[model samples]
Target: MTKPAEAQALPDPSGGDHKGHRERLRRRFRDAPGALPDYELLEMLLGIAIPQRDVKPLAKALIRRFGSFADVVTAEVEDLRAVDGIGDVAATALKVVREAAIRLARAPILNTVVISNWDTLLDYCRTAMATLPMEQFRLLFLDRKNALIADEVQQTGTVDHTPLYPREVVRRALALHASAVIMVHNHPSGDPKPSKADIDMTRVVRDALAAVDIQLYDHVVVGRKGHASFKAMGLL
Candidate 1:
C-alpha cells in the first residue's frame, strides 16, 4: 500500500496571526470604546492602513512622537510620512480622519447664531486651526441675525505672521452681505496670547468694519496650548 500523503499546513490569513489581536480589539471597542487607551485606538486606526504586519509598535511610536492621538491624526501628511512605517497611504488615512473630525465639529455651528453657541464655535475654531504649522487668518461672516454666512480663509503666512488687509475683509463682508464678522488666526508657537501687532490689527479691522456698519464680534487666536478671544479680553 502507498503511504498516505502528509498534510500540509495552511498559511495564516490574518497576517501572522494578528487577526486574533485585532478581533479582540474590535470586541473591546464595541463593548466599551471609551475604555481603550489612545495607543490602542491609534493601533487599530493604523492597522486599517497598514496590513500584513504587527502595527502595535508603530502606533506606540507615533503617539510618542506626536504627543497624543489627536496630534497624530492632525499632523501634516509630510510629517506623518517621516515616521518609519508611514507611507502616503497611511498619511492620507490619518488626514481623512482629521478632516472628518473637523467637519463634525464645524457642523453644529453652521447657519446658527454664533453668540448663542459660543463654546461650540470656539470648539470648531480650535479643531480647524489649532494644529496648523503656519499662521492662517480666517473670517467668519455673519448675517444680520448673527447666523454664520460664510467661513473663509483670508490668508496663510509663515509660522508667525500673516498679512491682513482691512479693506479686503470689508470687501468680503459686503459681498457676502454680512452684518458682523469674527476674525480667527493660529499661532504655530503654541501660545494663544495676542501680541501687540494682533491688538493693533484687530483695532484696524474693527474700525474699518464699523465704517460699513458691520459689527466686529471677536478675534480669536488659536494654538496648540489653548485659545484667546478679543471680546473676552475686552479688546473688541
Candidate 2:
C-alpha cells in the first residue's frame, strides 16, 4: 500500500550482490580449482573469514605488501594486523592456513622411512624454516625402524650462523635411543650451498654420533629458493 516515492525511500534489500559474487567465485574454484591467480585464492579465503565485505581489494593489498601468497599467510599476526583492513579474524585465518600447510607436509613423513620419503621431508623443512629471517638448526631423530621419534629445533642464530654442539647432539640422540639423525638448517640468503663451517660441523657431528653407533643420515641446508643434501653431494 506504500506510494512509489515511499518505496524508493526504503533501502534495497538485495544490497550490493556480494553474495552472488562470492558464490560465482566459489563455483569457479570448485570447477577449475587452482586455476585462479594467487590474489583470487586469497580473496576467496578472506571472504569466508569476513562475511559481507568486499575482500578482493584487501587480498590484492596483502599480496602486494607481503610479496607472495605464502609470505602473506606466513606473516606474523601483529604485522598482518598493521595492514589497513586485516583484523584478528583475518590474521588468524591466514596463520591457520600456513600452520595447516606445514602440518600437512609433515604428515606424510612422520613415523615413516625418511630415507625413502625424502621429498615430503624437504617439503616440511621448506614450509617450516626456509623462509625464516634467521638461521635455525633442527634435527629429526629416527629409531631403528627408520620411523621418526622426534623433530627438534636445537639452535637459532643470526642470519648467517647457528651455533651447534656436536656432543650435545649425540647425547640427545643417545638419550632418545634414536639410531639415526638428519640435520636441517636454513640459509636466509636463499642459497642452499654449504659453507666450510657447515661441512666441518657435519663431520664433527657424524664422528661423534658414530662413536655411539648412531647414523648421521644427512645434513640438509634449505634456502628460500632451493635445498642441498649432504648425502647427494657426497658430504655425508
Candidate 3:
C-alpha cells in the first residue's frame, strides 16, 4: 500500500512573518542607507538585542513612550527597562549606542582649536546634553590657541533650572589656565530659548572671567530640538 503524503501547511500571505520583515528592513537599509523611517532604524537596533523575536512592536512602543528614536537611545536605564519587553541587556545595548554617538561627535573636538570648529562643538554638546532629563551647566575651558582645555559639568539641577556661580566658573578657568570659556547648559523643556536668568548669568560670568582676564566666548543653551548661542544672537 502506498503511504499517504503528509499535507504541507502554507504560510499565510496576509499575516506578517518576523524573518521576512526583518530581512526586508535590512535589504531596504542596504539599498538606501538613509531612507528608513526612525522606527525601522530603531527596529533594526532592537533586533540585535532580541534574537528571533518580533521587535517591531517593541521598537514602536519605545518611540511612543520616549517621544522619539533619539530619546529611546538616550533614555535612562531604568526608564528603558520600564518599557515592556526591554530587559537589562536590551537597555544596556541602547545605552551603548548613545555613548558611541557622543564619542563620535566628540572625536573631532579633541586637541583641536574649537573656535574654528564651531559646528563640531555644537554637535558634541547636543549629543552629550540635549536629551538629559534635568538641567546641567557645563563649562568648556579653552587655551590661548583656542584648543579645548577641559570640559566640566559644574551643576545639575531640576527640570527648569541649574544653579551656577560666576566666581566659581572663573576660578576654575584660572585654575586650569584657560584663556577663554564657553558656557553650555541644557533645558529639559525642549526649548533653547534663554530665560532672563540665562542672560543675567552670562553677564555675571563674563564680568567675573574678565576680572581674571579670561575671555568668555559664548553661552550656549541646548535643548532636544536645537541650541542657542549668545554670541550668534549678539548677546555676548
List candidate 1 segments past 4 Å from native: 1-15
lDDT of 3 at 41: 93
Residue 60 local lDDT, model 1? 93
Which stretch of 10 consecutive residues in model 1 shows the poorest summed lDDT? Answer: 2-11
Comparing candidate 1 with candidate 3, which one achieves the higher TM-score? 1
lDDT per residue (tens digit) for residues 53-151 in model 2? 777778899999988888788676777887777777788889899889888888899878887888888989999988876799999999998899999
Clash pairs for candidate 3? none
lDDT of 3 by residue, 1-236 (tens): 43212101222343647878889899999999789888899999888877557788778998899888788887778888777678777787889999899889989998899999999999899999999888999999999999997988999998898999987898799899999999999998999999999999899899999988999999999997799999999998
Q: How does candidate 1 fare on TM-score?
A: 0.87
Give the Cα RMSD of candidate 2.
7.9
lDDT of 3: 0.87
TM-score of each: 0.87, 0.83, 0.84
lDDT of 3 at 200: 93
> Relative to the unseen true structure, what is the C-alpha lDDT of residue 172 in candidate 3, on a scale of 0 to 100?
92
Pairs that clash in candidate 2: none
Per-residue error (Å), model 2, residue 168 = 3.9
